[model samples]
Target: MFNDISGKYDFLNHLLSFGIDKIWRNKLLGSITFASDSKVLDMATGTADVALQIAKEKGVEVTGADISDGMLDVGRVKVKTKKLEDLVQLVNGDAENIPYEKETFDIATVAFGVRNFQDLPQGLIELHRVLKADGQLRVLEFSKPKSSFVFWFFGLYFNRILPFVGKLVSKNNTAYRYLPVSVNAFPEGQDFCDYLRNAGFTEISFKPLTFGISTLYICKK
Candidate 1:
């Protein structure tokens, strides 16, 4: 499903979120505290947006790993276009089995990608395995709003307008339709934080972004 929509993934993403996605990504980058020479692993890195941003902001060497070669193809083009080939690399790999040695990365990140994992716990464990001791891990994901009105509005938009527009633009009805269903079914807030703890990450904290439409989770190994 993801491979099929790779071409339109970034396009519909920016469109469906009204460009707020970029702002959110920037915020996630800002929250990251890393050394200049940090080696970062971006898992499930669709189009390498976060990985590129990390390199641009922190001058870190970034490796982006994703299961979809089609998505990595798009990300590679962007890296070339930005002249970041020296700093950023994209790999076709799964989150549940990162193709790297243990304790390799200084930082790990996933942007709106964890919910798509076939086995979330296995993916989290893999992330933990590759991260250096005391390394930082940041994750961005969709969440339900706390306010009733906002929740209702977001629900309507996601359940109705988003799927319609996503299908029209991406030409993948099932994929877009699955978006809302997945978000709705995925655990959020403290429930998700507890999952992180179970995966062996400590100092877990989450911050709601953009009126609680999404959340940024920070954890430590």
Candidate 2:
């Protein structure tokens, strides 16, 4: 599904969010606290945007793993263009079974990717397994709005206008439509925090971003 619209993913992300997507991502980055030598893992790293940002911080080693080759190809080009070959590496891997040794990474992140996991809890477990003791994990994902007015307006945009524009721009019929469906069906807030706890994380918490249009979850091993 993602492979089909890989080329237009980034553009549509920025366009659909009216460039707020970057601001959201930057917010996620700002909340991360790690040492320069910490190794970071970015799961479901479609297009490697999160990995690229981590590399820019300097000294940290970043590995971006994703199942979609098409998205990874574009990400690789961007990495090369940024001359971050030494700091960042892209790999073919899955969320349920990441291709890294247990306790390897000090920090792990997934941006708008957890909902796409076939087994959400298992994917969280995999993320936990790959992180060192006390390692931090963060997830950024779409969420339903809380306020009445925000919910009403955002729903119209998300369920109607956004998908239409996405389809028009990406020319992929099912991908955009599937996005809202998946998000709506997926668990959020406390439900998601439970999954993290079941996956062996501690100190779990989340904060809504942009009027609850999205959420940022933070936890530790």
Report lDDT (Cα) of residue 6, candidate 2.
94
Candidate 2 lDDT over residue span 1-221, tens digit each: 88999999999988889998888888888888979799999998899999998898646899999999999999999999999999999999999988888999999999999999999988999999999999999999999999999999988998999889999999999898998899899899999999999999999999999999999999999
Q: Assess candidate 2 and give its TM-score to the true structure.
A: 0.98
Clashing pairs in 1: none
TM-score of each predicted structure versus truth: 0.98, 0.98
Candidate 1 lDDT tens digits, 1-221: 88899999988888899999999998889888889789999999989999998888788899999999989999999999999999999998899988899999999999999999999999999999999999999999999999999999999999999999888988886998999899998899999999999999999999999889999999999
Candidate 1 global lDDT: 0.93
lDDT of 2 at 107: 94
Clashing pairs in 2: none
* Model 2 spans with C-alpha error above 4 angstroms: none
What ranges in model 1 sit over 4 Å off?
Answer: none
Lowest lDDT sum, 10 consecutive residues, model 2, at: 53-62
